[model samples]
Target chain A: MAEEKKRIQAYLEQLKNKVETQENYGGEITNEEARMDIRDCPECGAGRAYHKGLTACAYCGFVFMDTKLTDGVNIRKENNS
Target chain B: MSGNPLLEPIHGITLEDYGAACARLGSGLSEDDVAKALGVELPVWQEANLLWPERMKQDATFHIVTLFGQYFGQADQHPKFSGLKASASPEGAGNIEKIKQDKDFYQELEVARQVAYDYGLDGAQWIVDNYGIPIGDFQIAASLWNDQIHRDIQADYAGYNQRQAAYQAKYQQLFAEKQGGNVADDIEF
Candidate 1:
C-alpha cells in the first residue's frame, strides 16, 4: 500500500511537468483554431463574458462571440438561472 | 471464450483490465511493463490492445463497454489491478465542492467540448487544457449528476474516434487558414 502511494505521487509529479494528451489528432485547439473571438469590446473595452446564453461584453452590449444556446449535456437554461 | 467471442474479454483479460492497462500506458509505463504487470506476454498484450479498440468500433450496442472503460480507466480503486494506476486526473481535476458552487463552469465545459468537436479538435483534451477537467474526472462528476448522460458522453468518444479521420481532414484544412497558435488565447488588439 505504501509503495502504491509512492508510485502515484511520483506519477502525478511527472504529469505536472508534462501533459500527455492525444497527439494524433493534431495539436491543441487554440482559440484561433476554434475561431473564438475573445477580444475585449473595442467600443467599451469590457471583457467578453458568457451570461444567460450570449457571449458579449459584460458591461456594454457588445457581441463579439456567441453560440446558439440549447439544452446540452450539462448546461440548461432553466436550471442554471 | 464466452458466449460471444466478439464481445468477450481479449485473451481472458476483462474490459476493466484493458482500461486499467491503458491508464498505466498513459502514465508513461512501457508496453512491456504493462504486459508484464498484467501477466501476459508483450505480443499478447499488444494484440489485446489492438483488438480491444477494434471491438469498441464493432460494438453494435456501442456505449455499454466503452462507458465502463472510461470509468475504470480513472478508478484507482478498480478491483482488477493493484499497485498500478493510470488515471490522469490531478487532485484538483474534479472538485465536487466547486461543481456545487458554480455548476455553470461545468456546463460551460460541456458547451466547450461540443464546440471543440465541431471544430474537429479532441474534445476531451481541449476541456482538460482549458478548464483543468480531465475526461476521466469529468466522467465521475457527471455520473453523480446522471448516469444516462454520462453514458452518452462516453459513447460520443467511441463515435468520435471512429469518425476522427474525416474530422481531422477538415480541421487541418481550416487550421491552415490561421497563423500559429499561442497556448493561452490572450486579448487581441
Candidate 2:
C-alpha cells in the first residue's frame, strides 16, 4: 500500500510539473492572418497599413488620403469589403 | 469600512448597469445642466471639467476585482501592483499578526480595499438614483472567492519555498563534504 501511494504521488508530481512547464513556455495561439485580412488599407486595396501619426494614403502620398476633398478628413467606408 | 446600514441588496444589477444608469441620467440633461446641478451638488465635477476619470478608475477597479473573483476566486484578497510578498503562507497564525503589525502591509492593503469599496458604493448609488429604486433596497453582495484564491496561492508558494530550502540545504551539505572544510574557499577563479 505504501509503495503504491508513493508511485501515485510521483505520477501526480510529474503531471503537475508537465502542466506548469506547458503553461510557462507554450506559445499563445493567435489569428494574425485573419487580423491582417481585416485591417487591410481601404483606398489602395494594398495590405500596407501605415498608422504613422497621419491617417493618409501611403502609396499616393495623398494627405488625409484625398487631395480633392479640402476638409482632409478620411471617410470610412460603410462596408469596405 | 462598514457600508450603509440602510442599503438593500440589488439582485443582478451589474457595474455596466450602473454606467448605463449614469449615462441615462445625464442624457436628457444638457452639458450645461450637468455643469449647473453637479456644480452646486458636487462642486468637484466642474472643477475637474466634468472629466470623471475617478469614476472610470473606480469602475475599472470593481470590474477587475469582480472578474478576478469570478474567474480565479480571489475576490477578497487585496489586488497588488507587484512583488511575491503578497503570496505568503496563509497557514501561519503569525502571518496575520505580522500583517497587523506591519505599517507598510496595512497601508497597501487599505489602499486596494478602499478603492474596491469606493467603486462598489458609486456603482450602487448609480443604480439607486438612475433605476428609481426605493431607498435601502439595492443590496451589494460581496463575495469571498477571490480572497480564498489569494490564500490558496500563498499556501502553495509557502510549501514550494519549504521544499526549495530543504533542497538547497541538502546540496550545501553534499558540496561541503565533497570539498572538505569551508565550501567558499574551494571556489576556483
Candidate 3:
C-alpha cells in the first residue's frame, strides 16, 4: 500500500512538472499580464489601426502584415479589390 | 480531500447522461430545464447534479469523461434529448455547395498534433502506427492551426487584457481603501 502511495506521489509530481513547464504557464495571477498583440508600430511608435483599402500602417506606411483580406458574409465582393 | 464514492444512477440517468445534462446546463439552460429535458423530477435531478460533480472532484476520470460527454454527448445523445438542429435558407441552398466540417476529425487531429508537438517524431510515429492520418497532412494542419491560433490571439488579447486590467485596478483600489477603514481593536502592545 505504501509502495502504491509512493508511485502515485511520483506521478503527481510528473503532472505538476508538465503543467508548470508549458509555454503558456503563468506562475502568478496579476493585474498586469503578458500579451502577444502588436497594436502599435515598432518602427515609428504609431497606433497600427485598421484602414480600408490598405494593409499597412497609415501613419508610418509600415507594412503591418501580408495577409490578403477577403470579403465576408456582410462585406461586399467589390471591397476585395 | 474527502474521498467521494461513485453514486449509482438516480432515476435511470447514467453518469454519461448526467454529464450530457450538465453540458446542457453549461450552455445557459437552468437546472429545471435540464431536469424536464431528462424526463425526471427536479429533486432527483438536483441530487444527481450535486453528486456527479463531487465524484468528478475526487476521480480524474469523472472530469475527463464529463468533458468527453460534452463533446461526444452530441453523437451519443441520451434518448430523451433532441440533440443538435440547424435550419438553412433556401436562397443559399441552391448556390452554396455543401462542405464537410467534421468536428471529431479536427478534435482528433488536434490531439495528434499536440502529441506530435510535445514528443516530436516519435509522437508522429505513434499517430502513423495507431491512427491512419498521413504524417504530411498532420504536419500541414498543425502549421495552419498554429498560424490561426497566433492570429486569433493577436486580434483579441490586448483589448481583453486592457479591460481585465481596468477592472482589477478598480477593485484593488477599492479593496485598499476598505483595508484602511478596518478598525484594529486587538492592540495589546
Among these predicted structures, which one has the highest lDDT? 1
Query: Which portions of model 3 show Cα errors greater than 4 Å?
Result: A1-81, B1-7, B60-72, B83-189
Candidate 3 lDDT tens digits, B11-99: 44556667556544533346667777665445446666665566567676665444434432342245644452122245322211111
Candidate scoring better on lDDT of 1 and 2: 1
Q: Is the docking of candidate 3 incorrect, acceptable, medium or high quality?
A: incorrect
Model 2: DockQ score: 0.02
Which of the predicted structures, 2 or 3, would earn the higher TM-score when compared with the native? 3
Candidate 2, B101-182: lDDT as tens digits:
4533333333333332232223322332333221111111122223543565587978646654565555445433432323
- State which candidate has the highest DockQ: 1
Ranking by DockQ: 1, 2, 3
Badly placed stretches (over 4 Å) of model 2 are A4-8, A17-53, A58-81, B1-189
* Candidate 2 per-residue C-alpha lDDT over A26-47 given as tens digits, one digit per residue, 9 for 90 to 100: 1345666533223334566545
User: Over the true interface residues, superposed, what is the Cα RMSD of model 3?
Assistant: 25.5
How far is each candidate from the true structure, as Cα RMSD in Å? 26.7, 22.2, 27.5
**How many backbone collisions does model 2 have?**
15
Q: Global lDDT of each model?
A: 0.53, 0.32, 0.46
